[model samples]
Target: TTVLTPDVLIIGAGPSGAAAASLLRQYGYQVLVLERQHFPRFSIGESLLPQSMVFLEEAGLLDAVEQAAPEFGFQFKNGAAFLRGNERTHFDFTDKFTAGPGTTWQIKRAPFDHVLAKQAAAYGAEIRYGHTVTAVDVDGETPCADVVDEDGFAYQVRPRFMLDASGFGRVLPKLLDLESPSNFPIRRAVFTHIADHFDPAEFDRNKILISVHQQHPQAWFWNIPFADGRCSFGVVAETDFYAQFGDLALDDLLPAILASEPSLSKLLSRAEFDTPVREIVGYSANVNSLTGRHFALLGNAGEFLDPVFSSGVTIALKSASLCAPLLHRFLQGGSVDWQTEYEQPLRRGIKVFRAYVEAWYEGSFQDVVFAVEPQDEVKRMVCSLLAGYAWDESNPMNNNSVKRLATLAEICRDGRAARDALGQA
Candidate 1:
């Protein structure tokens, strides 16, 4: 077996891997990326939060992404629209208190991920496609990964440190027995892309649409439209909720589920499924630790919460950005505090998103979001969080989101009571 050596070895070519590779290369490290699949492959998480642009710019990939935007038919996204029956509300990212660009893009993940990997390759990171890591040994001073290519050529790679950005593959976690119980219950999503022609008058293509099921409080749907006139549609609900449709094929299950949500049904009335229906279940995961003796986890490799509010890519980029500088320090022989510097700060933002996600399903955040007239400051705070500024401590909502959300929701409930009393008088 041939032996390869690099300063850093990354296990996946997904967003987190590519971002980490790009940033590490900028810090003068020889980075090797291994991917089990080729580029432009099917994956979910197409929508991007505005804060991701900062990390892209830091990695010098912003221009490439900008050029590919029009070439790949990416839609410019300014905000998100939430709908539940007739109660509609929109939170414009631009209106938030964040300092960076208020708008981001909604692109096809396959090509978008390809572009990111390509950008990393251009930056001198060696990305080998079809290389699946079968085993990893991180107990040694130098971490090593055993890999096999599609052609069945096996090899070993030794790197000073490893970054497991393998996403849902969770390569390191599974190999090292690092898996931990997640706080979230099991959830499933049934999704597909559709060729939908949108009437600009009826739909604001500039923002993603999130519609909650009128009957099932635990259920929610996403409508992410692209510039190519195609939209990604999906529904997420508890696993038990989905089991009721057990054994039903996606084609039939999708239509049957969509019929239950009126807003989504009307919006997708003329749309036709352009791709086969796909389903993913129990995606919420966590790890016992984000780092070990010679390696660290990035993005979904470490933890993955629910996809409501589109936090997956944001957290992935955040993990990559957070891990890059500290990894650089370790490579340079500087004593790096892994837990204090890398994991704590990273999980802080994650906890903020987690609170909001839990509140969303509990019906409190939904009530606050769909309020007839919410306080301007509170709405902006919520918008800032939605825009991926969860780490900004200046935003009280980020500092203690659960308490603030509960308070705001109570205010909303009280306001409704007063209005009803006045109407009766």
Candidate 2:
């Protein structure tokens, strides 16, 4: 057996990369983290789901997160049919998900990434800020990285394993030639932070709020209130949904959504934005194949579904946790079995999430009639499902979605049968 170089080379110093590096270091392994950007950069997807609380505790960053984030758990409002609009539907995890008062965080990507990166460094993982990974030398039996620094000096960090936790599938996937195709179906989101006096209920505990304005299937917007009295609002429009709006800028997207929703229209008409609108082409799953002999990808680098549920943080940390044990075993003279453990379950999770996202796509959730409606059973079920409760194999796979999907599927069947009979007549 030959000796290897560094224990782990983590690409992308985002939350997932930081978690993997920090955890590996905690168990006594030499880890290196490289990031293309410095700390405190602008990022999107502010609202987080409840399951993320569990993962943050695992990463030992829970305390830090609580300090930086507001105390709001999660609230699902709007998205009801006209008949049900009198009473809005909301989800308080305290009611169901009995994992001991679990609550998620609404974090700005810049500060969140900065905290995680610094924590990883403090845990003894060597972190290089502004150092980008140009290429990876996976040809060797022990895969290594061909990296370039700020000075354009190229060198090799020969590590036993490489982890690409880069959000948006940066290096490995492209190198693996994992191109995201149009059939993949993506959405264009335009978001910005606004500080104009919107008052949530008094009992909200200053916690971040996740607000979904019903637009039906074409597009839907979100409002995530942070601890700083500012709410991050973004609109997710289906591919080419904004094609006709070319004359309009991103800042106008939110106002457009508000105009379509009576509730939001009144609320935001009195508000002002704190920043310029930022746009992103997001919520698309990546090509398969996350594992190779010496390199594995994590987070969005591997699989990214719609942000409707705020599962980005949870997905990355969850995947990293799964990889941790395997990496641990290998580090301790134990064999790493990629086939039995990593590949199969990974596939299942990805498929389950994809199916769930597809449902949202099909329904379009953008219809003002359905979105701004008050409390109703179907609306409750929809919100529960959206806020990270689809009940996949990881959690208790809820029968709710299957039931709803089945009910809808049957209606389609019945309608088809009637059509056939009429044709015969």
The C-alpha TM-scores of every prediction are 0.96, 0.82
Which residue pairs in candidate 1 collide?
none
User: Any runs in candidate 1 off by more than 4 Å, and if so which?
Assistant: 243-247, 372-375, 416-425
Q: Rate the local accuracy (lDDT) of all candidates.
A: 0.88, 0.63
Candidate 2 per-residue lDDT over residues 118-235, each given as its tens digit: 8888889888878888777677778877777788867778887889988874689887676555245667777887874665442142333334445344466566666666677777
- The count of residue-pair clashes in candidate 2 stands at 17
Clashes (candidate 1): 0
- TM-score leader: 1
Q: Looking at model 1, which ten-residue stretch has the lowest summed lDDT? A: 416-425
lDDT of 1 by residue, 1-425 (tens): 79999999999999999999999989989999999999989889988999888888987788889999999999999999998987788889898866787999998999899999999999999999999999999878798999999999999999999999999999999999999989888899999998877677878988999999998978999999999899899999988877766678888898889887787688778888768899998999999899987899999999999999898988999999999999888888899989999999999999999999989999988988887244456677788889988898888778677877777777676675322221232
List runs of model 2 lying over 4 Å from the truth: 1-4, 70-87, 97-101, 180-184, 201-216, 244-246, 364-404, 408-425
lDDT of candidate 1 at residue 19, scale 0 to 100: 93
